[model samples]
Target: MTDLNKLSLAEARDALRDGDVTSVELTEACLKAIDAADVLNAFVHKTPEIALERAKAADERIKAGDAPAMCGLPIGIKDLFCTKGVPSQAASKILDGFKPEYESTVSQQLADAGAVMLGKLNMDEFAMGSSNETSVYGNVVNPWRRGNDDAQLTPGGSSGGSASAVAADLCLAATGTDTGGSIRQPAAFTGITGIKPTYGRCSRWGIVAFASSLDQAGPMTKNVRDAAIMLEAMCGHDPKDSTSAELAVPNFEAMLTGDIKGKKIGIPKEYRMDGMPAEIEKLWADGAEMLRDAGAEIVDISLPHTKYALPAYYVIAPAEASSNLARYDGVRYGRRAQLAQGDGITEMYEKTRAEGFGHEVQRRVMVGTYVLSAGFYDAYYNRARKVRTLIKKDFEDVFAAGVDAILTPATPSAAFGLGEMTEADPVQMYLNDVFTVTVNLAGLPGISVPAGLDGQGLPLGLQLIGRPWEEGDLLNTAYALENAAGFVAKPGKWW
Candidate 1:
């Protein structure tokens, strides 16, 4: 049999249903691959025992003919998600040793669908960084290197581990959260598929808070079909999360007819940033041509608020983060500092926070606190909120004008070497989300499909942003682009 670990989620599901492979066999294969790929630092916590037990149960379900679409599939849960009794640290020291007593809504739904939990994947601390360097588990090394060079690259973040694991075939698919491009950017960098459904598509109850309004959970998978399948399993209404939508979930996989003829795909003129790399420009043009060849009408559209997305996001996300993250006071759970004899409760709080949180988390928290402060609330946070409304309106107006989806480059460039951007200004690092944050700000469903390679042979992706609550349309469009691009390149195994 071919490598079970290398099988896509859809293929594995079909194979399992046909009795060609047991869930245990598939789970073992992923566990073996994960054990050997430790250099990538992708799976921060291994749960082989739970995986095997769940796999056995899944096998029984398959035999009983009670299987769902995700039955018997081995998938990694992002650490941001709370899996009962599992260490879900959110890759932040502040959350060190924190294990939830209940599973996150999305993970529980996957579990209910008979998906086997392989383990928890790594991520940037509090989902704060773009390059995954801010992860307390060090950095998740991108499986794809630049040509023959030995330099280590990032898998993008804060969903870096999900991207790395899926790209490396460590797991068939993994859960990921997007707040300002976490899912799509990493998927683009690692040559995988990731989708962030419209806000409230997936319940955020058990996921660690980043930017409450901006945080969304989605699937990171090997292809568009797998993304659709896993996304369906991960989405639904949850009364636990007030923001979760009450709408019914669709059979996203069934919607992938890939017949995008006469579909109006918008190409936003504002996405053409000054001094953008020639390769990215060429890749965008090539993607548009491919879609055009596939009979999609590529039309230029304007999202005039594009330029303010990053700044507004930086302000708004940090502000919400400041409010949401106030719960980690050391008095509750996770890490607490060892106070000196003279230290009081106030000192303990200060010391615990100082020791527990990472630099990036602290920086964002400070920024958030500053923006939400009494004197600066209107000047910064409220102003950014108004800008966010304008940004949302920009997409609403475009979509109302008969555009089915908007196509653009997923990221500014391919995966860069680790520590390369960290050495530059932090704003340079934030610029990585320039092409992606607008989707989050506007609360729309967006997907990244690996479209082509860069000059150095690393992968580049094209993003398709669909109308609100229209992930099926977005995934089908992505499927069309996937067929047109025929991007079957996998990173050479180095880990």
Candidate 2:
């Protein structure tokens, strides 16, 4: 049973192929694990019947020699990814009772490649918060703990549940969408590896749009090789999504070499901000040293527009979210509050929205609407977009200067106490994404690998930001760092 929990997707597949284990056995093992770890609330919905049925089918396919790449592997789909006949809430009350008649392009693509869906995992309501605390379903606590400290710590959000589930071995790997650090941050918090591919690398067709322009779907798993395998299955061109890249997907799993010799890795000078936690700073330095020892050239590069990225992303993401969420006005899909005695159609729409959206989401919607309004449009929304261009330009300039990739900390600090953030102001919470958001704004590929642990023993993540559509290179570097860090242990501190 313990070995079942520790099995990688490759191991599980090999077991199935060798007849050492059956798909049903693997699926049942995961179901048992999910039931055992119920306190985590990692899964919002568990369709054991569906999962078993899928596993049985996979078993038959294997017998018939018709298996696909991920033949019998079970994966956790984030609730943000719409699943046909399965509730896809984005962890928001506003989207409650919303079940798409269609599957998200990415989810469908994975299913097409033969991966089994365990269930939908939890997330920050509408993918808004930095910590999972903002979830309407309640916080998903980290499965690790300090020596004597028993307080629950945050598994990073909006993809927190995906990270937690993968880390806890509730599922082999899980799908997570990144809009400003959603995937990588949670992966870091949970002491796992996750990647946010270049924007538009994965189709966002049926994904609940948080910040459409910034959103990119990726995989979260225990190791870089697993991430590479899952990511290969996840990426492709989709006619359903116009923004989906037409580029051919690479065989990422085949390219995971331990070699880094002669690779030009850049250390961005701007990311080394003041007040950075000492442990994180040390981890960055140590990571650079590891690459140097591996015979890779580490050069210092500058991204001058770094300071402006956080403010610009906050403005732009909210602005886009406001426009995207306006469709849920009580008439179409999603929940609708019962009308009061005197309420008309417009009043019904007003009442439904007020009752459905949570506090943080409401605040964001208001900010988004206010910024896009006639008078404030130029001052807030447009100006933020201009800054976004400058941030992208910074990356372009650095890349042109002969830097292959840039390295930085995935988050400003390690995962904070769940309630520690709620007590502070919203800007403080937003600042957590300071280092990760710039890559999203610049439309570049970024990934987080377990770097080291802080003095408190919480895991730290080192981020590698790559040029647009250069996920292969980013994953290669992350593979190197993953070996260097040697921190593949699961969440040891249980809340």
Candidate 3:
């Protein structure tokens, strides 16, 4: 029999329904795989009992012929989502031992759809860093490595564990939040499929906040169809979250006809950055050609404000983060530092924060506080907001001109070794999000599909940004790319 854990989410769902497989058998296989793959550090918090219980229930639902698309599928829940009675630290030391009584809206919806939870995946501390190295649980390693080297590589950031788990077959799929490319970037690095729905598409309630305006929860799956199915289950109008979209959800998987005929795909000129790795440029062009061959009309477009997106995002995300994270003081439910002699409330706050937040989180908090401070708010924070508006306008103008979607490279390069870019200059590290942050700024739906591999044989992905609220169309284009590329490379088992 095929390795039960190796089946994609969609395949597993069908097999469960057809009696070729049972949810319990699949869930147990995943549980056992997670146990053996601990060296990857993908599953930060394992919940075997809950997983098996949920699987048993899902099996009963399937037997009764009352199962949703996600029913009986085992998946990893990112630590960012609050699962009732489960640890959800968001990979931050301050939130250690922080378990919420309520489950996140997205997770609750998935549970209602009959998906089994295997465990919580790790992420960057407060979803700050571009690489997974900022995680309090330590970096989530990429299953793919350079040609013959065994050196550990990052699974990208914030949603790193989600990408790693899906790519490594630790889970059929996983829940991930994309705040400035968290989901897409990691998915690219891991050679999988991920889509960040328009900001506000997924309810933010019960998930730990990062930059409130930019954080969007989406699926990281082995294929685009699975991403669509899981995303449908994860999104809806939530009265609890003011940002959740009110429109009725569509059948995203059904929209995957793999036909982009007559679609006008725009190729933004600005994204051809100076010193971008040649392979990325070639991969972007190759993707455009594939789309064109699939009957998509490739048109040259300009997004002039894109150059400012990274700078603007660094300012806006951190500024909001500084505000959102203010709730994590010592008086909260999370860890409180040991009190010293004469330590009052003020001392407790300082000590707890200093001991809790990692270096990257602290650095951003300082930068955010500085930008929002009285003396510099206008010079920095306010100016960045203005830039963000222009960036959004760039996409709007292009989409208004009959362009169905915009195509670009997901990341400038494939996965890099852990600690390769972190120690020296931080700016070098921040560049990883250059291709991805613009989508967040525009609140546009974007997807990254593995198109080719880089020189090191690591996977490279092409991104397609769709019009706001038109994710179904965007996903259809991605399906075309996926079919055209025929990218089926998987990381050789080494862990």
> Over the stretch 1-495, how does candidate 2's per-residue lDDT look in tens digits?
345757988788788888888888888888988888888889998888888988899998898888866888888999999999998899988788888899999899888877889999999988998888877788898786654688788899889999999988899999998999999999998899999999888999999999989999999988888888899889999998889999999988778797888988999888988898788889999999988887789999888989999989989999999999999887888889898798898998888889888888988999999999999999999999999999999999989988888889898888788798663588899988988999899889999998877777788898999878988877888888788778856666242
Q: Candidate 2 at residue 296, lDDT?
A: 85
Models, CA RMSD each: 0.7, 1.3, 0.7
Which stretches in model 2 have alpha-carbon errors above 4 Å? 493-495
Error of 2 at 409 (Å): 0.6
Global lDDT of each candidate:
0.95, 0.88, 0.93
**413-486, model 3: which lDDT tens digit per residue?**
89999988955788899999999999998899999999999989999999999999988999999999999999
lDDT comparing candidate 3 with the true structure:
0.93
lDDT of 1 by residue, 1-495 (tens): 679999999999999999999999999999999999999999999999999999999999999999999999999999999999999999988888998999999999999999999999999999999989988889999999999999999999999999999999999999999999999999999999999999999999999999999999999999999999999999999999999999999999999999999999999999999989999999899999999999999999999999999999999999889888889999989999999999999998899989988888999999999999999999999999999999999999999999999999999999999989864589999999999999999999999999999989999999999999999999999999999999999999877
The TM-scores, one per candidate, come to 0.99, 0.98, 0.99
Cα lDDT of candidate 1 equals 0.95
Regarding TM-score, does 2 or 3 come out ahead? 3
Winning model by lDDT: 1
